[model samples]
Target: MESPDPSSSAPVLLNIGGKKYATTAETLTQREPGSMLAAMFSGRHTLPRHPTTGAVFVDRDGKHFRHILNWLRDGDIPVLSESEYQQLLREAEYYQLLGLADYITEKLSWKKGDGTLETELTRKDVIKCIQAQKTRFRGVNLSGLDLSKLDLSEVDFSYACIEKTNFSSANLHKAKFKLVEAACSSFEHANLHECELTGANLKEAVLDRANVQSANLQDACLTGCSFIETDLRSAHLQSANLMGADLNGANLEGANLKGAKLTGTNLQGANLQRAYLREVDLRETDLTGAKLGGANLLGTIR
Candidate 1:
C-alpha cells in the first residue's frame, strides 16, 4: 500500500450523511490527533469510496461537520443559535472533541465574551441577552423558564421571580434565591451546594437527587416538596415549612431542622444522623428505614 504524501496540496472529497464536502487532510486532523476524523483518515477502517467520485464516505452529520472543519481551520468558534450550539455540542462530543464541547458549554453559560458574568440584568434584558448571546442569566427574573441541564453556578436571583423554573441537572452551586418565589420548580439532580434559599417559596418543588449540602432554606416554604435521594447534609432548614414533603432516601446528616414543620412528611430510608429536629411537628410522618442515630429528636410532636 502506497502512503499518501502529506505535502501534496490535493483536495479530498468527503461524503458524510449524504452530503458532499471538499477539504484537505491537513484540515481534518488539525489540533485533533485523537479525533474521529483522525481515526477515519488513519486508514485503519475500511472506508468505502464513492462509486465514481472517489470521495470517502463517513456516517456523520455533514451540516455540523462544516462547523467542526471551520474550527479546525481557524480555531475560532462562530456565534451560533441555541439550537445550533446544542447540535454542535452533541457532534463535538461524538467526535471526542472534549475541549470543543467544554468551550461550547462555557459559551452557553452566563459569562460574556469579556469574561464577565451577567449579574445585573432585568427580566426583559435577560430574555434579550439569552436569545442574542445564547447564554444563561443571573440576577434577573427568570420565572417559568426551562433551564434544565445547564451550568448556572454562582448566580444570584435574590428577590427575583423564578417560579416553575426547570433546573434539573443544573450546576447552581452557591446560587442565591433569597426571598424568591420558586414554587413548583424542578431542581432534580441539581448541584445546590451552599446555595441560599432563605425565605424563598419552594412549595411542591422537585428536588430529588439534588445536592443541597450546607444550603440555607431557613424560614422557606417547602411544603409537599420532593427531596428523594437528595444530599441535605449540614443544611439549615430552621423554621421551614415542610408539611407533607417527601424526603425518602434523603441524606440529612447534621442538618438543622429546628422548629421545622414536618407534619405528614415522609422520611423513609432517610439519614437523620446528628440532625437537629427540636420542636418539629412529625404527626403522621413516616420514619421507616430512616437512620436516626445521634439525632436530636427532642420536643418533636407527633
Candidate 2:
C-alpha cells in the first residue's frame, strides 16, 4: 500500500507539536517552494503521522503555526499583537522564511510619513503632549529604528540611549542630544547643522558625509567614529574627545576646536581654514594635506 502523492489536491492534516490543523497540499507547497513545509511535503521521504489521528507531526510551536499556515494559504497576515508578531517572526526565521521575517521587521519598524510635511504646528502638539505627561527620554531603546529622511530639527533626545539606530539622510538641525549615549549608531548623510551634543557619547558611530556645520559637541566622546567627507564647518568642539575618529576630506572651515582631544585622529585632507585650535591635543594625529590658513593653533600640542 503506497502513500498518496503530496502534490495531489488532497486535504492534509497537520499535527504541529500538540495542536492539529487541516489544510490542502497545494497550500503548503505554493509560493515558497524552499520553505520547510514545502520541503516536508515534497515526498522525498515519508513523514511520520500521528498514531491515533493519522495527521503529519511537526516539531514546531503550535501557537504560532496558524500564522504560518495563514500566510501560506492566501498570503493573508493578521494584525497581531506585538508579542505575537515577534513570536511568529522568530518561528518564520527558524523555518527559513526570509521574506516573511523581513516584511514583519519593516512593517513594525519603518516610520511611515514624509518628514518634509511635518509642520511646526504638529511638532508643537507632539512636544506639548509628551511634556504634559512629564515623559523622560532615559533608558528608552530605539535600536535599529528607521527614522530616515525626517526633519527632526529641534527634537530633544537628551539623555536617551539610542544605540545602533538609523538616522540616515535625515534633517537633524539644532537637535538636542545632551548627555545621550548613541554607540554604533548611523547618521550618514544627515543634516545635523547646529545640533547640540554636549556631553554625549557616540563611540564608533557612523556619521559619514553628514552636514554638522556649527554643531555644538562640547565635552562629547566620539572615539573611533567615522565622519568621512562630512561638513563640519564652524562646528564647536570644545573639550570634545575625538580620539581615533576618521575625518577624511571633512570641511572644518572656521570650526572652533579649543581644548579638543585629537589624539591619533585622522584629519587627512580636512579643511581647517581659519579654524580655532587653541590648547588642542593633536598628538599622533594625521594632518596630511589639511588646510590651516589663518588658523589659530595657539598652545596646540602636536
Candidate 3:
C-alpha cells in the first residue's frame, strides 16, 4: 500500500529544502537530536510560518512529523543517506524507539571486503556504531557472521545466541553481558573493561587476553570459557557461577565474591586480597595460592 500521501492536500505539510510536500509535523522536538535533522539544526532549513501555537512543527491539521520513528519501527525504510541513517539511530534510541536503531546500525555495521580483510566501509557506518547505547552487541544471533576488527564498544549482549561468531580484535569497552547465552564464540584480544556478566552462559567461548578491568560477574555461568591474563581488578563476583572456566592469571584483587560458585573453574595466581567469600562454593575449582589477606569469610560453608 502507498504510504500516506504527504503531498495530499492535508491540514499539515512539510517544506524540506524549499520543496513543499504534505507531511505530519511532529510535536515536542529537541534540536540536534539526530543526523537526519542536521540540516534543520545547522540553520539550513528555513522555518515555515507557524500553523498552531506559533510553533515551527505544529500545523493547522495538527499532524505530527514522527515519520522517522514510524519508519524505524517498521524496518522497511527506503534508501537513506548515511548521515540520515546514523541520525535516525540516535534519535530512535533517545526517543525509546526499540529495534529501530539496532536495525539501522546493523546495516551500517559490516562491509563487504575483498577475500583477505582490509574490508573498508563508508564512514557513515562508523558513526552508527558510535551511536549505539552499549559497546558489545547483546543477545544478537550473529551466527556464521564475520565481524572481525569492528569497533563495537559498550554493547549489552545479555541472553544472546552468538555461536561461532568471530569478534577478533574488536574494541568492546565497558559492555554489559548480563544473562547472556553465547557458546563457542571467539573474543580474542578484545577490550572488555568494566563489563557486567551476571548469570550469563559462555560455554566454550574464547576470551584470551581480553582487558576486563573491574567487571561484574554475579551469578554467571562460564563453563569452558577461556580468560587468559584477563584483568578483573576489584570486580564484583557475588553469587556467580563459573563451572569449568579457565581464568589463568586473571586479576581479581579485592573482588567481592561472597556465596559464589566456582566449580572446576581455574583461578591460578588470581589476586583475591580482602575479597568477600561467605558460603563460596569452590568444589575442585583451581585456587592455587590465591591471595586471601584480610579477606572476609564470615558465614562461609567449610
Candidate 1: 10-residue stretch with minimal lDDT: 1-10
Better of 1 and 2 by lDDT: 1
lDDT string for model 1 (76-149, tens) is 46667767888999999998877577656754653245533333444455445544432533334566777777
For every candidate in turn, the CA RMSD to the true structure comes to 18.0, 18.3, 14.1
Local accuracy by lDDT, each model:
0.80, 0.78, 0.59
- lDDT score, candidate 3, position 231: 69
Question: Which tens-of-lDDT digit does each residue in 18-104 have in candidate 2?
Answer: 899998767777767788777777666577776786788778889988988887864446656666778999898888776577546
Error of 1 at 148 (Å): 1.6
* lDDT, residue 210, model 2: 96
The TM-score obtained by model 2 is 0.55
TM-score of 3: 0.53
All candidates in order of lDDT, best leading: 1, 2, 3
Candidate 3 stretches with Cα past 4 Å from truth are: 1-139
Better of 2 and 3 by lDDT: 2
lDDT of 2 at 275: 96
User: Each model's TM-score, in the order given?
Assistant: 0.55, 0.55, 0.53
